[model samples]
Target: MELFFKYLQYEKRYSPHTLTSYHTDLGQFSQYLEQVYQITEPAEADHTIIRSWILTLVQNNIKPRSINRKIACLRSYYRFLLSQQQISVNPMVRIKAPKAPKKLPAFVPEESFNTLLDSFEFEKSFEGQRDRLILEFLYGTGIRLAELIGIEENDIDMRAKTVRVLGKGNKERVVPINDSLLSCIEEYLQYKKSEFSDNNSEKLLVTNKARPLYPKFVYRVVKKYISLITTSDHNSPHVLRHSFATHLLNKGADLNAIKDLLGHSSLAATQVYTHNSIEQLKSVFEKAHPKA
Candidate 1:
């Protein structure tokens, strides 16, 4: 298990969050094996025993998606064992993933996003301008909160209107910036530089006391600004990302283009935005049709 985790971190380049999840999932599976089957080694496991374990998970009312993830973990574990001559056959060969429900991601309305941005008065005040720029960049770029917080000053190119982002798996991609956001970022950088010059902080966004921005701080900033303009309870960086993708899809952007812009690993991941577009189309159809 330790070797597998090392493989995930070093060879596969999985993010810390993904590595952590794999650890929890695999740890649970190992504990179940020890407690139920009295099997401490991977070689002692077989297809029937694995099947019973999955049945137990189902009986416990675990979500199908979560069960599927556990199955994947087990499959990977067995494959590793096979390579090491611990097991000859992979038990998960014929196993099928349970059907998962098609649930759409929640996104804030465009009006609400606009209101959120407008509610911010970006005066020369250090905190005000910093908060406003953070909101602007997140909505404009659709970058993940981690990527945004991890951004260095040199990652942005105002001249080229592009941001060089290091996304999941440490893969780098250049996302374009619009004119308005370009202007905002430029002004914000100037203010940030002047404000933090005495303290020598390299991060793009910081607290009023010249500290690096943390995840909780970013969430609070988003919540505070969004609460002023939106009545929705879900106001976070992820909601902004959803809105960015949904709005692009609504504007007739190509699905592949949206995938590249959002830095998704697969087209299936990007397809979730299609559901939002379909909902919008349904609304337009119901409102415009004369035959009721």
Candidate 2:
């Protein structure tokens, strides 16, 4: 398992969060095998044993999506073992993953989003400036939470009006920044420098005390600001990302261009935004059709 993890880290260049999930899923499966069948080596387990585990998970009311993820983890591990010649047959080769429902990504309405950004008056304090920038950065750039957290001072190219993001799989992509977002970033940086003189942090967004931002803090930041303007039940950094993509598509932006901006590995992932676009078209048609 350790060797396989090292391979994923060094060769596959998987993100730290993805590595953690793989470790947790494999760990849980190992524990289940040891406790239930007294088997310590995953290679010793056959398809029947794996099927039983899946049945157990189903009986325990595990969500289909989560079960599918676990199955994926096992599939990857088994494939690694096969490549290494540790196992002659892959147990997961014939196993079928359970079907999971597809949920449409949630986004804030354009009117409410614009009103919040334009009408609200944030305080002059460094915290206020930083908070407003955090929300705007996510909504404007459509970056993932981890990507935003990983941003450094050098990532922003002020003269070029672009921010370089290190995305999943250690891939780097440059995203364009509008004047409004760039101004906010500049203001936040100035606030950081003037208020926290002794601090030497390079991370773009930080706490009031100049500490680096974390996931929980970012989540709270999104929830608080989004709640103020929109009644959407789902509010998070990803919601802002969805809003970015959906809004762009609504305005006739090309699907492939949005995919590149969003740093998606494939167009399939980007195509989901089209659902929102189609819904918008339906709404317009219903309101404008003369026969109605």
Candidate 3:
């Protein structure tokens, strides 16, 4: 396990968060195997043993998507073992992951977002300004929460009107910013500089005390404001990213361009947004097409 982790850390260049998730998933599976089957070695486990673990997961009411992620962890580990010649046969060869339902990404309506930005009552405090800029930054750049938090002061180029984001797998991409968002960033930076003079932080989004932004803090901030405009129950940071992509597609932006903006490694990953776009197209066609 340590060797595999080192391989992933050094070779795959997985993020710390991703590495932690993989560690937890593997640890959980190992504990389960030991308690249920007295299996001390993962490579010695067979397909039927893996199936029982899957059954246990399902009986515990774990979501299929999450279960699939756990299974992915096992698959990768076993594949590593096989490559190292530590295991003669892969236990996951015939095991299939449970099918997860397809759910469209929830997004705020463009008009609603516009209204929120235009007329929402934000306080005159630094926190309020920071929170407002957070929303606009997420929606404007379509960056993931981690990428946003990972942003440093040096990453922003005011002259170029772009922010360089270090995305998943340590991949870096430059995301363009609009003039409005640029101005908001400028305002927030000025506030940070003046109000938190003792703060030596390099992170772009910091607290009033000039501490780096954490995940839950960002989530709560996004949830608080997004709940005012959206009741879809998914008012998280990623929802703003979805809204950003969906709005772009609706505005006739090329899918490939959107993929680049979102820092998606594959076109297939970005294609999910097309389902939302297709639904929108269907709605318009139903209302406007005269053939009916």
**CA lDDT scores, all candidates in order:** 0.84, 0.92, 0.91
lDDT of 3 at 178: 99
Cα TM-score per model: 0.87, 0.96, 0.96
Q: Compared to the true structure, candidate 3 yields what TM-score? A: 0.96
Q: What tens digits encode model 2's per-residue C-alpha lDDT throughout 201-232?
A: 88888887788999899999889999998776
lDDT of 1 by residue, 1-292 (tens): 8888887788878877678778988888778889988888756877888788788889999999889888887777788788877777888896777888877888878887787676656677677788888888889989999889888778888788999998999999999999878888778878777877787777778888888898899999889888877788889988889989999999999999999999999999999899999989999989998972
Model 3: per-residue Cα lDDT over 1-292, one tens digit each: 9999998898988877778889999999899889988989888789999999999999999999989989998988999999999999999998999999998898999999989988997876788889999999999999999999999999999999999999888899999999999999988888788888888888989986688998899999999998897777889999999999999999999999999999998998888999999999999999999994
* RMSD score of candidate 1 (Å): 2.6
Query: Candidate 2 — which residues are off by over 4 angstroms?
Result: none
Model 3 whole-model lDDT (C-alpha atoms): 0.91
Candidate 3, RMSD to the unseen true structure: 1.3
Which of the two candidates, 1 or 3, achieves a greater TM-score against the reference? 3
Model 2 steric clash pairs: none
Off by over 4 Å in 3: none
